[model samples]
Each structure stands twice: as structure tokens, then as C-alpha cells.
Target: MMTKKHLALSALLVAVLATTAVQFFPKTIQPAGITPPATAYRHSEETSSVEKPCSNEHPEWREAQMIEGVDIAPAPACEPDNPYEVATSVKGTNNVSMMTLMQTDLAQDALVMGEDVDKDGDPDEIHIKLEVVELNGSSPDGEFLINTYPIAPGIQPGLWVYAPKSRGMALKNFNSMVAIPMLRAPSPTIRVEQGDKVFITLENTHYLPHTIHLHGVDHAFHNSKGEDNDGTEEHAVFPGKSHTYEIQPRHAGTMLYHCHVQTAQHFMMGLHGIFVVEENHPNNWVQTFNVGAGQVRHPSVGVKNTYSQEYDLIYQSIDKKLSQIIQNATDPRLVAQRMSRDYNMTESFENYFLLNGHSFPYTLRDGIIAVNDNENIKLRIANVQRSAVAIHFHGHKATITAYDGVDQPEASRITRDVFDIAPAQRIDLQLSTQNNGVNSYGPGLWMFHDHVATGTTSDGMEPGGNMAILAYKPLLDENGMPTMHDDLLNEVFSKDYYAKKQALWAQGDFKHLLGDAGLIVPPYWQIILFGLAAGLLIGLALVFTLKRKQA
Candidate 1:
């Protein structure tokens, strides 16, 4: 039992066990009175009168139900084989004239108004159908399912532009694939002519109640028969219902349409867009709506004669905490309770700013307002956000022609580089790109952004929010995308680069930052190091024990 070989083996075994135990059961320290952060999604204990499951409940389940007899179902998956096939069409007679709006092929029926009663080669009756849709739920890109926009790479809750079924038309059409619902903020811009009999039907497809209030536009409290047509708090269209708003505005300028119910919450939740009413002129057949914002191909007569191109810039700020409510709750009751009752509007803060629908680098992709030398472009800018926005043009001064859909007199119109737009205010500016150092500083990559310092940063990250460029055609790439200098392509400009993740950052160079080397070592190297240390300690212990035994 006291043999040198037996004692040495015993010492070696003890050292090996000690090393193994240290590796397996690492030390942990938790300070007293410390608590972890709360989880992102949480449920409240508030219960409704009827404790029913919210599997397919309407948004206003507690309110008195008004059956409009409309079928509401979840958006169907995109059919790969028959993606752009036309479903059916309907023919109907309106009060103004007998219209033939053809229903095109797509997921949502598009009312193609090809008839011209005025003999001006332009349709006089403007009919548009819109459905409320939820974006970034379950699928970020929805039917597209692909990374359509390479920039702004993250899942976030927002509204989408849905082409609903119109009278005498199916809901799906060819534009459905290109303009798929459930993408980003800034609801589709509704464009109409001054004298055109405008019929905008809103399909309440979302779980919540919504109404399209034509803000600052010419409309009465009631229709011709004294029916409640004014989209206000009283006439809230509940889910699964539909409402057709008939208005023929005489004035022509930039207007707005948004949900009036729960003003502070719903409007800020991205339920508003630019509503442009162009002057009634000969051959003025404007595209009823621009699903999301971009170039207006067929400009109005006034714009066509004056400006070469037109762009709609919808400025909005998002409170991540408020918008995330939709992402957190799956049930309709929970969402309604949290959004209506629990959520505090006073504590709201802006975390993200958007121009059109996207932030900075992404804005450069689609939000770029490309201009040619000596071209006059009409900029219909609207401030949908709560705070006042000071819009500044980098290299040129713009002439303000209209304010709040009302034209300013020529003498009163001011030419300024920075235009101050208050909340719910719209400004129509005529940007002259003469490039003679007077109208503009000669066509280069000029930036157009909010002068408010915070508006330029996204979630407190600089050079990452509502910034866009007004670039000359010469400065653009082969694909018509604007080309910026490498200085703007820094690590901090990237969405994931600021977070310091190796995968999104420098993948090959920043390997050391991936893990804590001291805390987490390679398995093979760790085993070798532990074995050598244990063997050396065991040998020393054996020598010491033998010396002591001899003594």
C-alpha cells in the first residue's frame, strides 16, 4: 500500500479530478439586490367581458358590432404558377357616368380606369381601393420573402399598401407582385385630379379599426344624403368592414389622409400618406395612387407644364417602443389593451426617422430624387411626425409655392434653403436645378435631410437615418442608383457594424472579438494545457511525499 508506484498514481488521479471539476463547475457571482431585464414581450392580466379566445377576433371586439357583410381573411400565399393571373371583373354604374374599370391580374384586384368621358384622353372618374395590411409579421418581406431592400436589414412592425377589391374589379392585379403589401412605413400616396369624381374605398383587413380622414381637404361633415362620410372619430370603420369615401375637391395642392381615431397612437403608427389633388386641367389623368413613394410618371397638367418631375416626400418619426407593441402580442385583445390602455403616449420618444419609407442608405436606393441640369422638379413635402422638421437642401434653394394645399401668391412665395414644416403641415417646393451657382451649386451629390440633429441618426446611430440625395443623372451608376464616396460607407454607417458583431462587421479580420479568449478557449488546446499542468503538479507532489517519508 505504501509503495512509491501506488502513491504516485494516487497523486496523479487527485490532480486530474481537481482540474476536471474546475472546468465543469465554474465559479459564479451574483451581486445582492440585482435583477435581470424584463423580456420584450409580456402579457397583461386585464380581461374582457366575454373571455373568448382571440383566434380570429376583430380589433374592436368589445364595441357594438356593425356587420357590413364583407369577407376578411388572412392574406393568401403567393401562387408561383399563376402569380399574375386575373381572377374576375365586375361592371357597375355610378352617379356621375357609366364607368368600366377593368380588374387586372394579381393578388389584389386593380381597378383599371381606361374610359374617358371628358373626351380629353384621360379618365375623369378616379376609383381606388385600399386594404390595411401588417408588415414584418411572420414574414419580413411577406409574399416576396426575399431581401428586397438590401439596406435596413431587420424585422420591425409597420403598415403596408394593399390594393383591395374595387367595384367592378377584382383585388389582385399585375402590380400586386411589384407592390406587395407588408413591406415598410409611409402608406401608399393617393393622387387624384381636382374635378375627377374620386372614390376611395378602404377595406379594413387589419385586426384594428381604421378610417381615412382626408386631412385639410375639401369635404363636408356628411354626404349628399346626410350620411356620415367624413372619416372622423364617430365614423370608425371596424375590422372586416369597408367604407367608400366620395369627395370631389375643387382646390389642387398637397393634402393628406390618415386614421383620425386614436389620433396620438394610430396616426403615429404609420397610418398616413401624401394625398395630392392636382388642378383640373385638360388631359389630366393622374395615377390614382402611388403605392409607396417614388417618381410620379404621369404628372398633372400644372406640373407637366412647369416641372420636369415630381416626388412625394413623407416625413415620419417612429417610436420603436410603440410600434413594437404589434410585434409583441399575437392576440387581438392583448394588442388592443396594450396599445389603447396600457401604452403611455406622454413618454413617447423618437427612435427612428424615415423619408418616404426607408432610412439613409436604403433611401439612397429608392428615395433618390434624380435631377438633370436646368430642370425644375416639384417636391411635395409633408410632415406627418409630431415634432417640427426643418428641411434643408444641401446645394440649392427651393421656392415655396403652396402651403397646406393652398397656393401662395407669387410675391409671398419665398426662396429658402431650409423650410420649416410644422406637424401635419405640407409644403410644395419648386426646386430649380439650373446648376449656374445661383439656382443650385452645379449638380453634384447634394444631400436633403432634416436640420434637426436627431433626425439624421437612427436609434442614436449617426449617419444612419432619414438622409437622401438629390443627385444629377451624370453622378448615378449604370443601374440608375446614386453613387456615393467611400467615406459614407464606413463601418458605423452599416446597421450591424455599429453593434460590433463579427458576422456583420469585418468577418475575417475581427475574429478575436467573437469570444472572450480567457473565458472560452479552444477544446483541444484547453485539454492539452490542463493535462500538462495536472501531470507536473502530480510529479512534484510525489517527490515531496517521498522525501517526507524518508525523513
Candidate 2:
């Protein structure tokens, strides 16, 4: 029933699709089995407790958690919006306030550390001022005044922690560049009590578009009346606008938030943060975490260590070539266009990755963990990406205790050199640097990285992004701990140099910054050759059919 023209068109499409299919076929890997000894693992015990320490009492177990590889560098304290801690005369003990944050190219994806106007141990109020300032020899000519307002308290403390949706960008000050939490988010934490109500208002101060979408925690989109509920399209905060999202996460677990509006770009630009809700009913304080790991030795009435230590290792891959597509957008008109455009999926990619916002060698938290003697730990890992990630370390096998924030004793625990991490997948793995069965391995420095070789690279450099180590060092007296923090190490371990370099590589140098668009596509010239041959054969067959028909 096919017409001659239709058949010919179909043949061409088939050839093109055939070539694509063969060229980009999916690759699969069978991960090695991680079956721990049946007797060694106590599935029946309500608590999985360990009896020995990392050093086995040999005297080296001085520190419970030691960071290897990266030198320790504590980021300097961010400047308060107001140098003089002025407290606003806000009434209620747990008062409520609201503010709108406008989106600007400068404020595009910066971390906001607004002034905590109320001085209630929380950034009671946040100010998001996004506007264009005239340059006077390189800096804003005048006092660039932006709106500052009080927003409602985030997730109540002692309950859950919710990651904010954006970052605050800083301006260059003379020869030095200062970091100002422009988005003005309070801090890296949120507070809550059990059964407490929560309200958050987001004012769109930015010119472009924006919205906040709670990742999990079963929030209602709209109330019975259908107003802008917790999770609804109507809740979107457009440019020069504002909106408040309210929710009560009765359930306890880690949650996330991102700009639902234009998620592809906004989320890629660091619009996501972790929301952890703690279980705090009557007669209960939040259980103490194992410090380094989110492990809880003494579970608070309704709490469990889960996997032990829970760290929200948010993985993001950036294509510097594309970052410039947004970062370098000088003109406001063009910047808005790029942000709103949905046709650039082809240019999207993962050239750089991040763990807690920094790479390895920069991850060592003072290069040590301080525990009483011995302890158990857990790592809450999440692969927040569309691509697959392979996580591997030089030492230790992780027993996965949970996935997607749910405890899973029934799920098989696999220990391997590499584990594939899928997009939006969270894996809770119980880890300990101390090797019980293996005696030869020393309790020292060991490296951990992504098994997928490509995930390790920054926008350009190899073996980059989210690389860190779990250092096991002996707990020493007070003298052993290096002055809590030092300034010299800060400069030495700085990743700013490499981070920018990788971005440059992704841009493909000045010569071909946007270079050939086909670069994103993997080359498979062999597939093209096969496709050509197939096309030739089809042509010959068609010619023969035509001759027969004519006869």
C-alpha cells in the first residue's frame, strides 16, 4: 500500500535512524556480587552494632574519621549582609515573614546567605535584590539597593532539613573576588519540631522566570479550595513576583527542592538542596549524629542510624561550554532568551561533577574523624543526574542499607570496586574504613572516586570532580588536631584554579568556543559507512523493481 515517494522517504529515515541506533547503542555492566558472610551480618538484631574499632586497640584508632588526600581548608566566614548584627523587632517566638527573590543574570544560580534579621539562630528574613547596576570603572557605582524582607521559617528544626533552591552570586571587588551569598539563603540548615507547621514564601525578585518544587515528602499541590497549595502549577513564582509554599512533612526523611520552572537549566545551575525532617515528638531531642557519618548510635525513640552516617552527596555534571552559554550572556535580552529556550538539549552534558559543592583533595575535613574509639557509619548517597555514575573507592566495601530514603534490609548488599548510580537514585551504604577480615591493609590514606572514568573528569581535566578520601588516623591528644583551622592550607588546597581551567577546556578554547555543534555527538564513522552500504543495496533493489514493472 506504500506509494513510491512514501517508500523512498521511509528508506531515508530508516537509514538515518539505523545509523543512530548502531552508533549510540546502550552499554551494560554486570556488577560483582557483594554477599557478606551470612553469620557475620545480623539481620535479626534490631541494631547492627560493631564490637571492634578501626585499629583493633593497637593504639592507632585515635581518630574515628580521617580524611585522606585533600588538604583541609575551611572556607572563610561569609560576610553578614549587615556587619552590625542588628535584630529586627519581630514579635512571635516562632514568627512568620515573607519575601520575593528576583532572578538576575548575576544572581542566576548563586547561593544566597541573607542576613538573619531576627537573630533567632536562623536567617529569620532573607533579602533577594536582583537588578542591573551601572559599572563605574568596574564596580557598581552606587549602593545597589535590593529588596529585603522577612520570610517564614523553613522546615522546623528537630524535624527535617530542606535544601534551598538557589545560590547568591558575589561581585568582583578590585583585584580580589569576594563571595557573597547573593541568593541570601540563611545557612546550610533548617529547623523543625514534631507536628509543627511550616510555611515558606518565595518572592521573585529576578527578571527571568522561576518556581520551587518540593522533590518528595508527599506535600499537597492544592488545598480543597484549589488555591496555590504546596505543590501546584499555580504556585510558580514568575519574574517580579512572589509565592509561599506550606507543608507538614509528618514523615521523617531527607527531602529535596528545585526550581520546577525550567528545571533542565535551573536545576543544572544548582537549584536543588536537601530537606531532612527529624522525628521529634514529646520527650525527645533529635538523636546525635555520628558527626562525620549520619549514623546514630543512640537512636532517638523513633530514629535509626539507617545507614549510619547520612551525607547528601549531590552529584552535578557541568558542561563549561554550556555554562558560558548562560554565564557569559552579557546582554539581559539575550540572557533571558537562553534561559527560556528549551531547544538546547543537544548541548546539555556532564563535564564536571560535585560532592558537597567541591572536588577531592579539597574534601578532607581536617583529614580526620574523632570517635570515642570504634563506631559504625553510613553514607547517604544520591545521584542527582540524568547520566549513570560509577562510584568506587581505593578501600572499603559499602553495605547498602537503604535506597531512596527507605531502609532495605531485604535488598542485597553488594561490595564492589564500582557501583552504577542512576539519575535521581539515592543509595544509603553502611561504610567503615576498618577492614575486619583483611589484615594486610593499613589504616591510612585511601582514595574514592567515580568508577565511570568519564564522571571523574571536570569540564576538561581527567580524574576530576567529587573525588575524596576516608582517612583513618590515630586519635591523638589535643595537640594532634591542627588548630581546628588554618589559613595557609586554605590557599594551598583551593580548587578555584582547576575548576576554572576545566571550564575553559569545555569551552574548547577561544578559537572554537562554541565551535562545531556536532561535538556533542559521539563519532561513529564506522556506523556511517555501514549505513551507506545499506542505502546502496536498497537503491539497487528499487531500480530492479522499477525495470521489472516497466517490462
My TM-score estimates for the predictions, one after another, are 0.70, 0.53
Which candidate leads the pack in TM-score?
1
Please report the candidate that would top lDDT against the real structure.
1
**lDDT per residue as tens, model 2, 1-551:** 44689478758866886666674743221111111111121112112221111112212222232122111111111111111001111111112122112311122222223344434333322222222111111112222111110010000000001223333433323322222322222113232333434455565655455666667654677633565655334456666776666666666655555566666665565555544455654433232111112112223334333323324355555444334433233455675576567338567666556554443333333223222213355455666655778887565666766666565765566655566778767676656545564311445445667777776655445444566554443423232322323332232232322323112223223325544332323345656766777776776677677677878
User: Can you give the lDDT of residue 484 in candidate 2?
Assistant: 22
Error of 1 at 99 (Å): 21
Error of 2 at 102 (Å): 25
On residues 124-233, what C-alpha lDDT tens digit does candidate 1 reach at each position? 77666777656533222332221122124232333333434433222124332212322345776777777767677788977888888999878767766576777888
Instruction: Give residue 27's lDDT in candidate 1 (0 to 100).
Output: 37
What C-alpha lDDT, on a 0 to 100 scale, does residue 391 get in candidate 1? 95
